[model samples]
Target: MTEFMFSLSALCRDSRARRGLAAVLLGCVGLVLPLAAAQAERIKDLASFTGVRENQLIGYGLVVGLDGSGDQVRQTPFTQQSLTNMLSQLGVTVPQGTNMQVKNVAAVMVTTRLPAFAQPGQSLDVVVSSMGNAKSLRGGTLLMTPLKGANGQVYALAQGNLLVGGAGASQGGASVQVNQLNGGIVPDGAIVERGVPTTYAQNGMVRLELNTNDFAVAQNVVSALNRRFGGQTATALNGRTIELRAPTDPQGQLAFLSQVENLNVTLPPARARVVINARTGSVVMNRTVMIDEAAIAYGNLSVTISPQQQVSQPTTPFGGGQTVVTNNTQIEMRSDNGSLKRVSTSANLADVVRALNALGATPQDLLSILQNLKSAGALRADLEVI
Candidate 1:
């Protein structure tokens, strides 16, 4: 009976101790979980809504008022054709079989962007670029041209004085210029004549697409939206998108989306990656990248060769047949002292950079070293050569 009582007392003490340890561990975990989820960004900064994108507007137009610096009608027949058609539209008749030598007009292409949700009579900036060998477009005026979309419908009409921020001068076959003279921009030169049809706010659900595809970010977005609004309000559709229930009416939908956009959600940490530009010998790495302990040896081998010229003449000035020059080639070679040094695994980007800089190699040599490390299974991150 005494032994039984002793054993039971020991068991009770152990049970209490175990419970205390579990409580302590749970407390530590609760503190760490929030810190891991503390880095957050606004919804508007991380995602964009579908059907709310810009539309490209393009049209062919004529740029006139140039001073003897326009396309040659003989070299660019298209410019001549365009000019003839434009003149005909303005009640001018061109005689057949007549050669025109005008140097004051240029054929150009006008481009602009029609933003989403744009209404009629709104102004947009337009860009005009010359399509021929026009010397300059400093004082050109764009004619009235209708900008069309993919549906063959005119969405805007662009026409205004070009804002050329470039200048040039030519004299006696010498020319000098600054900036670009062939391209110019006109501020608020296009008037929106029509609006593209959109299906946004049609359904009761709104979809959000992330700029970067990350599953953790998508889940976090869904969770944050749900907590802010209510349950079943938001759900993750995939790694790149999240779907949320919204109001049916247009006004309410806009207000709800505005709120959602302002709400901030935490972003997950980035993955380990390394980017290398082969052409420029540039190296870029993220913080999460690490290296395993390894040894490396780098060296350079170079050979130099040049021609040495020597001129010989006889002591007698008139007796020498002619001054003769001899050329001899000299060759030299060099090799650096290559030694192996041990490097431990690096914990962060700073340490990795320090270790790499210790080799005193050029960017091209470093490229070879990194590639070799990846091939040898020492690098832990993805090696991308672009």
Candidate 2:
């Protein structure tokens, strides 16, 4: 009877230990799940509402009040013509055929963007760039320029003192400059004369367009919205478009959109891609990029040329022979031997970077290797050369 009692006690202790281990594992899983969820991104970042975008406005105007850094009238006749027209409009017309050489005026192009739902009297920032042969635009004031949209309709009027972020000095045929002297900005320098009409909610519905065309992300967005609001609140129209049922009233629609944009959704893994800048020899790759085992070899070839000049004269003085000059050139060519290197297969970004660095090649040489790897079906990513 005592033996039976001891066995029962041991079995109970074993069962309790198993239960405790299970609870600890569950706690660990709980912590991991939330950490993964925290990495999700808000809907506003991945997509934008249709018809809610900025419109580009462009205008041609003049920047005046420069200190002898304006456009030369002889070289740029447009400046002279613009000045003449402005003077005539102001009831101060010069006599016909009169040469008006102004050294304080420069022609510039003004550009700005009109935000969606912009109201009249709203102030906007404007960019002024030189359109003529002007040395600088510092200490200049932009004249009244009417910014027009693509439809050729004036939307805003820009006029303010230029805020140039560069300085330059020239003396004794030597010049020093910093940043850019040809362009400047004016903060809150433009007032909207007209407002653009936007249809935020059309027919009691709104559409969301993803910046990247990924069907998985679109579906995830719809799922997130539906789970928050209702089953029929969101629907995927295509790989890039998602339609949502919204309130018809403007106030309710605004609130609904605000909430919808704030909701977080987990995103799928990004596509593997590598971007290469041909001019600067820069290579950039995403984390999803992977490479298979491959072999690479690269070498450098150098050529050197040396020239020697020789003069021939008569050995005896007063000999009837003219001195002649001859040139001798020596050319030498050398090529460094390149050894074959093996690149191991990489499953992660860090491993891939380490493997590429082991090749001891410059970025310019890496470009050719990457292209060849892609051709050989070793690189499992899209290669884009910019």
lDDT of all predictions, in order shown? 0.86, 0.90
Off by over 4 Å in 2: 1-39, 303-332
> Compared with the true structure, what per-residue lDDT tens digits does model 2 show for residues 41-94?
999999999999999999999999999999999999999999999888899978
Please report how far candidate 2 places residue 329 from its true position, in Å.
Answer: 7.2
Note the residue pairs that clash in candidate 1.
40-266
What would the TM-score be for candidate 1 when compared with the true structure? 0.75
What is candidate 1's lDDT per residue for 1-386, written digit by digit as tens?
A: 00101244555579786687678669878966886676667999999876678899999998989988888999888888888888899999898776788899888999999999899999999999999999898898998989998777899999999999998898999999999999999899999999976655547988888899999988898899999999898888889888879999889898999999999998776788889999999999987788787778877999999999999888797785888899999999999888787666887676688878776768898799888888888888899999
Cα shift from native, residue 216, model 1 (Å): 0.9
Candidate 1: count of backbone clashes, pairs at least 3 residues apart or interchain? 1
| Regions of candidate 1 where Cα sits further than 4 Å from its true position | 1-38, 167-177, 279-282, 295-343, 361-367
* Pairs of colliding residues, candidate 2: none
TM-scores for all candidates: the values are 0.75, 0.85
In terms of TM-score, the best-performing candidate is: 2
